[model samples]
Target chain A: MSGRTDTINELVRTPPTSFVDSLARARVRDRLVDGVAASVGDLPSGALVEVTLASIRRARSHPEALGQSEEPFAWKPVFVRRSLGLAAVRSCAEGRFALPSAAVGPVADQAVEEWERTGQRTFHWEPWFAGLGVGGRAVVLAEAAAWATSLWAAFDWTTLNSQVRIGGMDDLWTCPAPRTVRLKGRSEVRTRLDMVVDGRRIAGSDGGPSALVSVSGGVPSEGWREDLAYLALVAGLRAPDRPVPARVVGLWPDAAEERTVEIDEAALDGAVDRVVATVAMTAAAARSTSDDRPGCTSDSGTLVGSAAA
Target chain B: MAGPVAGPVAGPVAGHVAGPGTSGSTPWSASWQPLAGAALLERLRVTGRPRPAADPVLSSDLRSFLESGLCEVLVEAAGSGLVVTQGRLTRALTCRAHRMDDQSAEHEFTIPLATSALIDVLFRQLVTTGSIDDPMADALDGLSLDAHRAPLVDWMHGLAQAERRELRSEVERQADGLRQRWPALDPSWLPRTQTPLRAVLAGGQIDLSVYVDLVIGRPAADVASVAFVDVRSGARRPGHRDDRHLGALVEALRAPAPPFAVATYYTKTGELDVDPVDSDLLVAAARRCLAGIRAMDSLGRGEEPEGTGSESCTMCAMGLSGEPTPATASIGAISNVAEAILHVAEARVVAPSTQTYAQGQAA
Candidate 1:
């Protein structure tokens, strides 16, 4: 089989151990931080930019499309399946083997309770979920259950390292740029190698070089390498003091397939280019809107306004 | 060689029950997959859950026996061979002449008169998210999202207002029935909808394919844990009992063991007929399968298919006429083209049909 196929087979069949990058951790983070700073230098002050793998890909492929106004995000069955599925996975990762069908409703209720306690109606999911009729709620449960089953079936949970991180807020990286910019890399599965000291492998509880594992839909695209590398970059940026992830593993469960991208200098640079291109496109889109209507706070009103708000 | 005609097949097995009153006191082990959702099925509940007598060793032996027998049948058949689906098996057993007609006919995309497919789509949505606002609108939107259903969706949109109203009412009635019967299934049951099973034989030339509407519970328990539920939007048919049987056989071939129970939930009448799976059911289903494959092979060889003078003969494409002939029905109908056509036309006029022939096809 080809090397690419071999990498995916190894990834699916065995616990990941061989793909660890040999690059120095500190040097790589410095290079990535510098790249981020240079990329967003031209954006206006107090502009909030959130770069996700989706955003970077869209920026590369459909830059002009970004400038056009977007419809506000709605709560579709397809949209929240992953979010609710991840909650079930969190429970599973913590040794509670509950199916998505059983866990999603309770977790959603918990989220609404939390939202109610804080009196935060900033996001409409809690209210929308709370207000749905029995059938509508059941539809949400069905969609999420299917999503969770896919994730659950993809990995043999018993075989993974006990410290595997499922999903949470820790994956977000707030880039230390002049403007308010954040790169979010919400991975489905995260595993760290045992920390080694003096050439002997040490089973440290934490603080070891890790790998980011994510699940994507359908097949891998041409920008898959950059997409995974962007996640690795965000993970590194999120914890600069710790070691950078050696690699990023992407699994497409629908096809029973996977792709691995080693997070070396080239992959990180590609990710940086995509992020820079994304910001540039957003700025151009904002400027074009401003030119069309002759200025009414277009800088803040464009991409940043909707994202930040 | 004489082909096994439809009427000679054995009568319905004794294991199935039409409605509720099943014992529900089975204590579940820790590793056992839970069927908390099945427990709520008041109408479809079976008497004391039937545990599989076959252990893993016995299950493996049964699979090998079925596979070898099925493989032998396929090896004896001619040409590149056929993919045996659940629909084909049901048809082949109920009426061989009709099955042959379907096999010989060319497929055409026509506007559906029946609302079962729409009801099915809506029912699936209900399964996923236990609520629906407008059945007609949700079904349309759901159909629109599917690339394959674009043509059907467009056709529905172009339908006359009267037809649309009729269709919506039919769908709404069924949707109500579905909601009334189907309980809020516990997520712990790990209810999976539209689960497909395929078992290949004769080097992938012959595929036994079945798409179960809903499969509850996981396999790998001490007792049989998985339960298969088939949703039906129309009135229940005698042949419908074979659905879960066929599903169980195919699942047994693939999984470590067969599912514990199989149910058919009729959405039009709110009737749920359930049966427990056992070695006898699987063996009987296998015998029927072999007979169907033999009939299919006979058709493949260009031999004329025999007609059974049963009640469904009125709707039969063969248009066979005359009284029920238990002994000679296979050769009873020798109608010429014009007579056959006239008989079919008269049957259509005489039959007080609630649904159009096309609508029945959708079901």
Candidate 2:
């Protein structure tokens, strides 16, 4: 047991954490701000917001109350100037499209969905007529929440460890003010899920990580209603320490009539695995191309074998 | 008097996981104290070897059949390495098996654990959740499974049945043709003489019995001695750089007290003579094989034992291609020296502006 613990301990300390400098953090910030600016643009006018708010609040005079947070932070932009920055992000990252692109698409797609409709411009609205009922504002709120969450998510993506923000109404739309990247690496041999369950103590209830399930109060619906639940299930159950036999099944289409234990479990396991693996592979490919890993700290650069590539 | 055969006595436990609970690998909960060395796999190989004549006819025919240009080759780019066209090999074998009249057996495309972990993770996830909306379904269509299975499964099954029936009918159809055309022939040579393998537990019961022995036997050569050449891509490279791994493999092959032998098997293009490994290779490979392993040991330096990285840098397990990209820094490139410099600079930048000016004047 001691030997095993020792082995585990070594895995913890041995790997290099980074090869790039704070410059990496700076690069990440630049890409993110650029991505956002390209997709969506500046905030909405107070008059426009006031009108939309008034229309929705007619049923209830205090318009700020409906699912809308009274908390001041909730007042920030949703589909406006923030989306342009995301658009910029999408373009810059478009070239290395495969790396963690899956993660990016959810955020961008949601923002795009908000941009195309703009709540004020939905089929339900006549820019002249009350601009997309409360539902439209709901969309804006959802989009804003999503953008904010994604910015936070970017912190996960960037090298800048300091506090960061994604979308603010004024001055810098998505500012981490680029300087340098100093990123951290993931752990080795934490492959097993008990670490998720017990060791790493990732505080998720039986339902699973709320972060995985929730974008915020809002679901990134365009990317939502998709198989994120399925993905969450997979990530939750993935056998880290060793391989496990798995099956992803649904009630077979024909089973609808006699919903009683209709035994048909199609193979979805390998498909999901491919998606996760592709993300890792793509990132490894980028680092390999730059031959830049050589400059990063050993822990952060890559797994011993991955760096070789 | 004897023990299990000198091979992976357990062949993936017939669709079982390689962890505890059932037939999978060591469970995560169970502290992984992988047996002291290759010593375990090696010792097991020796005491449990299956008996055979000293000089059995080396199945060179199997080798020639596998490597021969009798089938078409296919290749795909995999993230870890080039995915060689094993399709030709599989097809050639299937055809040969049909011609020889052995239709019931099945062969699956096998991938090493390290290379296939991503798939394993997804599969595990699928098992847990049981449903994938259009998003996952679209991503899955791009893999070898869909590509290979879609166009081939039905075609091969049809060919198998047709070939068997056609061969059988040819004999009856040409009793006259057989006599004159095949006077020197055994007469039965033209007929399909295969005993198609099939098993049935009941009308709808699950029956999974096989006649062939499918054991895992590593190549006899040391990791250093062998070369992993992509036969289709013509991408050939030595299997290992360090010789210590090779020495471990050798020790396993020639375990005198334990008694092991190099076991050989034939694949489409070549024959692999493998032996049970000794204690050394496992330890050495374990230390270095992280890079090759899928999605594991990256943060902790897959090869090194004591390393840590951040959760942000972790590649998304979900398969969303359109999701917002993580920062380049999130991919992890900051060095310790860089970190120190960054901290100092931050200190310089954050320190009182007046203090900085005074220090500059004194210097």
Candidate 3:
């Protein structure tokens, strides 16, 4: 626990101010975007996390496995519960309402209802919800409500502007590049920082500094700061116009604790390096599989290698 | 928070069903009727016409099963990207000439994006309070005033004095109309605006997603108690009734039993058209959705699905010849469509960023 805490503390330390900071940040963002674009070239669009996890798994087990089909990711009740809990907390935060455990059920119900209404089968949680008995569903909803209550209690909702606090699954940041390379950034809560400009309190524009708040579970894990940095990087790349996120705050409800990662040149560079490596690995894995296919063409190999280069 | 209260009264109204489906019973049925799963399969058989022989293989086993009634040969195509939305489904069903083309245009999205953001803000406010005092001001305040919405806001602010005056007056009128017509919804109803609805069909091989404008009622309520509301700005167009029915179908499929009803409200005309959720509505809506999925599957297979020439073709940008000039074009519609298009584009741009950022660090 002490070692993990130190790692988390070191990751959250204040960043240095330097003249080349902006340039460094820009370079990192561009490299990350280009790397992601290269690896994701014309591949099926998926969340960054999904692609990374899949790539890592593929790399470890049978990296040469040919003709493998992507397996459907099954979403469990815990995912839905977490998502619903976040939504409940967000609604309360943005609407300036008191947190209530009862509010969680409706939010969960609405999520299910929305999933059904939209016919988006990609949600993956529908089957889980459908499989639950009435009592089982109630328990899930209760747990979600409790989770939301804990989160709401942990934050000072009034300090944040109710109107500006973007929450839920809505604020997904996406960067689509040539050859169908697509990357997405998902945050549970994002809000613009108010800057004092010329003696006037003005809300930052999308291009201006902003804070990203993510809700997670358990103790701070390895690469947690890099994750936040990557989110900031992707968010910046997607907008290009918007300023890189000022800071990212990770909230762990179970522990009733939080870790803040300030976005800086070093953070951006770290994120870029990690993403480039992941994308290269994914591209290599994809290439290996494609090479073993029945009608494999040399052209496909060239494309993958050149893109990853 | 308060415990669940008694459900709202269900009743029927007289009007053409808005998006798709047959007109029959009242808006709210006295009893809940579940949409049988088999009924959807039957509807697909009736609606999903076969495409050309040269069409590519329908990729997923689930899709092929839905189309050909054969569950075998579910080949999961490696890395296929397919996103089916309500608008795309509506277009697939209503348009005669369908060609999949990139319709990305910078200018095409200006008006609609602004309108949607404005409307979304007002609705969000409405969910908090039963009524809106000043729609324009309230909406402006609610906007994050970010880069994406800045142009829309600027355009809004750049209006001529007279135009601004007219806009404000219109906003006030619409807001008042919405307030008067809107039922005294309990805060406990947990009304949400711009709620996303997604589901996996055919064993997670096909994904369908859409966003409902406003939804009220608890999921824990009786299956027949939840209600879905769609807000529109213009006079209802042809096949618009089917859209509402689609909303009903979505709710019915997701609910413990079936939803109570679904309604479409026209802010411009102050018209509210309601349709009871029934097996018939679900079947009809499912047919359209299935037909859409089939069309999408065909498109995915490098085959052009036949389009049923209709009013939707006017808005189709697939470069089909001899298309009629859009008859339903209006300032409101233009803005709405623009906003919807840009909203979709923005989401695409943002989704990947968020996912990557969070996932990258987690890794």
Candidate 4:
């Protein structure tokens, strides 16, 4: 659907149903939990290590580096665009669909007001945004508008499944392997499942499987499947009681590329292996550094690393 | 982005649409009084009629015509297709010799953060936010977002305070002119900035790429509805009237219909030159495009290209000094001033030749 000129409607109309049953999902979760625990068993207690897709990619690219160098992250326009664009898209989805150019400033203002009223520093965005002058803020709005416009144009919203969710809580999995390791996967859209049992629809059934959509920036890579698998693994571990996503679609609008990965037991196993490797890398990085391990702050203020990879 | 697929409409000519004067305040601004954005929109709305939908047959025919012309040129040169961007097209059309040298040049030069580049970035902000505060600071912050410009940013940071102040003043003045002339666009207009357009012709032998500064209106409407605007910071130059290239490219890129109108907004003078799109414009643009491709091919084969020796080519590397004879002093003065400012700023960033630039400024 990326560059084929076909609308996204076709992709979601007759989605392939999930074949992995309740027992299989539970088994996958148990395997992931055990794999993660075993990977970080030797790490000292209370040593918090953050693991994310970016850290995994970094570790893979720089295998020779003993420890990951810590750099204080600043809010660049690109990062701000993604953050504010997500909010604008959410606004469009909830109220009315307007061009991103018009929605970004108002949504940004609303965010600032919300922060001012609550005085809760959930994320660093509010303080950073408040500090910017009008010129800097205008730049943020312009960048975000372009970002949101690309996303809004990528799909025909009126034709998609009715239960589409945009920019909510991303899939998160926190593991207490005696070292308090956290894993995160950022998803842009999720189509909630609509299932009926005995001629009656279930509100939120544990067996139902939703579809996750990740709108990425760069071109799709060879590790796209693994990337989606990691998200599935996090989703599974986050809610071990519920079934994982049925499918994960990664959309790269700039490159006009899209790839879909179906979640199953084998896919979850691959994801578990990826998590074990990431944990091992993080533990090594932690050992190499004498200073305290620094938790990576993502765009959404997650304690784990960024999902930008 | 292509508009929705609709029925084909008959090609209609939009005549002499005028609006409140967006005349330039400069001495040379007297001749060009383009319509403001509001006036252009008003003219389109008042004169627009319910036309037919997008005609697939017409689009296909146009594509075939373009391919045939491009292929004829390719066969003559016996060369494979190469990428031809809008800049290359403009360069080739202005002076084929300059275009040829530019293509073959091995030296990589950095473009200083001049007023033109600053306006280009700030235009996006204006379209999105409908206003601007400090154009200088905003443009710097915007450029910093691009990782590839780290070297340029470093160079900018190392500039003297006085030089930085001069650049900032120029940027602020140009940005102010832009804001005064530019109108606030509605969201329903669906104004998108820096929309990429590509048209592959002759079985991918010729890849034409261009980015429309701003695009509005929904595609695939009952009639031609979309509009394309190209933002310019420098004085209006020759070949700026050929917006038909943009229209031709958009149509060739699978747009259900050609844009209703194409415009060029000069930030220096707050002039918005709008031209309605007609079949003739697209045809002319296609013809010009073919000529450009043939010229590029000729240059590739080491064949000599003709030089216009126009003031636009005064800086041509082919020794086309474009000296200003007494008969063309007025026109030459405008071009010389703009060129001198740009060339000097570029030199300041790439080299240490500030004395000449300072002398030019004093004169």
The prediction achieving the highest TM-score against the true structure is: 4
lDDT of 4 by residue, B259-315 (tens): 656777777666656554545455456555655565566566676433233433423
Q: Relative to the unseen true structure, what is the C-alpha lDDT of residue A8 in candidate 4, on a scale of 0 to 100?
A: 46
Q: Kindly report the root-mean-square deviation of model 1 from the true structure over all alpha carbons.
A: 15.0
TM-score of each: 0.53, 0.20, 0.43, 0.64
TM-score (0 to 1) of chain B, per candidate?
Answer: 0.69, 0.20, 0.61, 0.68
Cα-based lDDT at residue A86, candidate 4:
80
Tell me the lDDT of model 4 at B93. Answer: 44
lDDT per residue for candidate 3 within B106-176, as digits (tens), equals 34434445555666556545544445665777666555323456667778888788777766776676666
Cα deviation at B169, candidate 2, in Å, is 16
Question: What C-alpha lDDT, on a 0 to 100 scale, does residue B149 get in candidate 3?
Answer: 64
Evaluate all candidate structures by whole-model CA lDDT and list the values in order: 0.59, 0.23, 0.49, 0.60
Specify the poorest-scoring 10-residue window by lDDT in model 2 chain A: A253-262
Say which candidate scores most in lDDT. Answer: 4
Per-candidate clash tally: 16, 101, 57, 7
Query: For residues A1-309, could you state the per-residue lDDT of candidate 3 as single tens digits?
Result: 122233333332223122224576567757766776776665433323222322322333334541344434454445565666776776676563455454665666666777778866434566577555443454355445545654454444555544245454432334445433334456666766556568776655554567776666533444668766766766676666556777777865433246777778788787666666655565655555566673332333232211100
Winning model by DockQ: 4
Instruction: Give the runs in model 3 whose Cα sits over 4 Å from its true position.
Output: A1-309, B1-78, B94-116, B131-133, B145-151, B158-163, B253-255, B297-303, B311-363
- Measured against the true two-chain complex, the DockQ scores of the candidates, in the order shown, are 0.09, 0.01, 0.03, 0.17
Cα displacement (angstroms), candidate 4, residue B247, comes to 11
Model 4, A77-116: lDDT tens digits are 7778777888787777666556677788888887888889
Per-residue lDDT over B152-207 for candidate 1, one digit per residue giving the tens place of the 0 to 100 score: 77777887998888788888877776666567765555577766566654544566
TM-score of chain B of 1: 0.69
